[model samples]
Target: MSKTWFITGASKGFGREWAEAALERGDNVAGTARNLDDVQELVDSHPDTFLPLQLDVTDRSADIDAVRKAHEKFGVLDVVVNNAGFGHFGMVEELTEDEVRAQLETNFFGALWVTQAALPIMREQGSGHIIQVSSIGGISAFPTVGAYHASKWALEGLSQSLSQEVAGFGIHVTLIEPGGYSTDWSGPSAKRSDEIDAYSAVREEAAKRPSANDPGKPEATRSAILKVVDAENPPLRIFFGKAPLGIAERDYESRLQTWREWQPVSEEAHGS
Candidate 1:
């Protein structure tokens, strides 16, 4: 059966690819970008299948309207992919209060608003998928990506709690933790800290490394993600790409090792 996908940030990257894949599979897509004109070609080619909407995921009214329009067009929404977000690369202390808040506003709260808008419709239907395109940073931390990590980590926590809340209604939540895919996420949108003396030394070194926009083996990662997203019963958390899997594995292992190494001390401190 072909599912209906209402995806945010479909102008580029994973969201655009996913929308294309969905349409290729005979699914209907209501794709949104900050300016839907950017997706004019997609919409024009698939007039019936692709519905492009001008949307800012951060805008509450726009979210509501998008959901309404999607439901009106398809009658039911099978999936809502919250893929609209950017990255902020800087040490925690280096980021200004507004920058940190902006990170959360777009990556975390933007997703929340979209999901909140879609939940009622899905609940009424009694089935739907809510896929959040988080990042490996969600599960693990890195040197200059602390604010980015915080945003994703917030999504992970929100999704975990939301999964529990909506499980009874047959609504599913999937968090896609992708590491390095050749997306513009790492372009100028990827924030960098100013020359704050506290982080300049480390920032300067990290700045030389490639970002998500850098050339990479993205096809394999895209293929893996398509398989997961199109699967009948996809996993709650997906770690896509080689870098993501490696980071996830190392993070899990490090956590386990820490727990084991501190078991006795923790037990004594907690009296457990």
Candidate 2:
């Protein structure tokens, strides 16, 4: 059966690729971007199946309207991809309150709002899938991109809780933790804060992680998301790419070690 998809950030990167993939497979897609022109070709080619929506997801009301329109057009949305977010690059001190708020507004709260907007439709329909595009930064943090890390980390937590909350409604939530994709996410989509000289040495090293130019083709992620939505029982979280496992392993192991080391002190507070 052909499913309908509502994807944010559909102008480029995984969002665009996913939209293209879905349409090629004879599915319908309503792709949202800041400018509809970016996705005009798809809309032009698949006039009946592709919907190009000009949207800024940071606005909760706009998100609500877009979701409502998509549901009205498609009748029922089988998948909702919250992929409208950009990378915020900077150390914790380098980022201002406003900058952090902006980053959260788009990356964290935007997804939350979209989820809120879609839940009613999904709940009413009795089945749906919500794909949250998180990053390896969500699971592990780096020096230069603290703001980005914080945003993704919050998203991860939010989606986890959402998954539990919506399970009774047959609504599935999947957190996609993709590593270094050659997507425009780090290029035209990324925002940078003013550099602080104190963090320059580590900042230079952190810059080597990944970006739109280095992440490489995102075909695998596009494929994975499709499989997730189509599955009868999708996993709560799916981490993409090879690097994620290594980073996750190290981070978890280090955390475990610290927990074990502090167990005695931690238990002392219990007053047993």
Candidate 3:
């Protein structure tokens, strides 16, 4: 059966690629960019398969409407890909209140609102998949991109809980932890903190690191996409890129060890 997929931030990055991949497989898609015109060419070429929606997921009501419209257009929603997000490359202290809010609005709350809107429909249908395009930072925090990572980490936590909640309804969730991709996720995404001078060394080093937009590693992105898209039962957490594996692995192992070390104390507190 041909799946019907709806993706946000679909003009570029992993969202665009995922939509194209789905369309190539004869699936139906309703892809949204803040400006639908950005994807007009794609929609024009695949009129039968692609429906472009103009929306900003941060707008809770708009997101709900888009999901409803997508369902009406396709008659079913098999997958909802939460791919709309941006990064704020700066230290917590260097960022402004507005910048922090903007990052959370798009990266975290946007996903939350859309997922809430999509879930009931999926539950009613009795089958669906929610794909969250989170980053390696979703699980592991680094030097910069603190706010960005917080948003993703929150999404990861929300999705993790959601996975368990919806499993009984035949709804599965895939939290895609892509390290870096050859998408406009970096150069275009790299936002400067107003207080850059206050944290110059860390900020400069962070800028040097590749992002999803200006990924220094195209091969890594390609490899990750291929692997992730082909997995039979893809994990709840997936780490992409040459660097993420080693770094995330070490972090994961260390966390586990730390947890084990703390278990005795935790058990005593719980009266176990």
Identify the leading candidate in terms of TM-score. Answer: 2
User: Model 2, residue 53: displacement in angstroms?
Assistant: 1.2
Local accuracy of candidate 3 as per-residue lDDT tens digits, 1-272: 67898899888877777777778778899999988888987888799889899999889999999999999998899889899988787788887898889999999999999899999999999988888888889988888789998899899999999999998997888887877766656578667577757678876676566453444443334445445544556577766555677768789999999999999998999983
Q: Which stretches of candidate 1 lie over 4 Å from their true place?
A: 207-223
**Per-residue C-alpha lDDT of model 1 across residues 46-143, encoded as one tens digit per residue:** 99999988998888888999989999999999899999999887777778998898888899998999999999999999999999988878888778
Candidate 1 local Cα displacement, residue 191, angstroms: 2.7
All candidates: CA RMSD in angstroms?
A: 2.2, 1.6, 3.0
Q: Which residue segments of model 2 deviate by more than 4 Å? A: 210-216
In model 3, what is the error at residue 241, expressed in angstroms? 3.3
List candidate 3 segments past 4 Å from native. 207-234, 257-272
What TM-score, over all chains together, does every model reach? 0.92, 0.96, 0.88
Best of the two (2, 3) by lDDT:
2
lDDT of 2 by residue, 1-272 (tens): 99999999998888998999999999999999999889999988899999888899999999999999998898998899999999888888888999999999999998999989999999998999999999888989888788889899999998999999999999999998888877767678788899889988897787666443345458866677778889999988888886777889999999999999999999998897
Clash pairs, model 3 backbone: 183-213, 184-213, 185-213, 186-213
Cα displacement (angstroms), candidate 3, residue 101, comes to: 0.9
Clashes of 2: 3
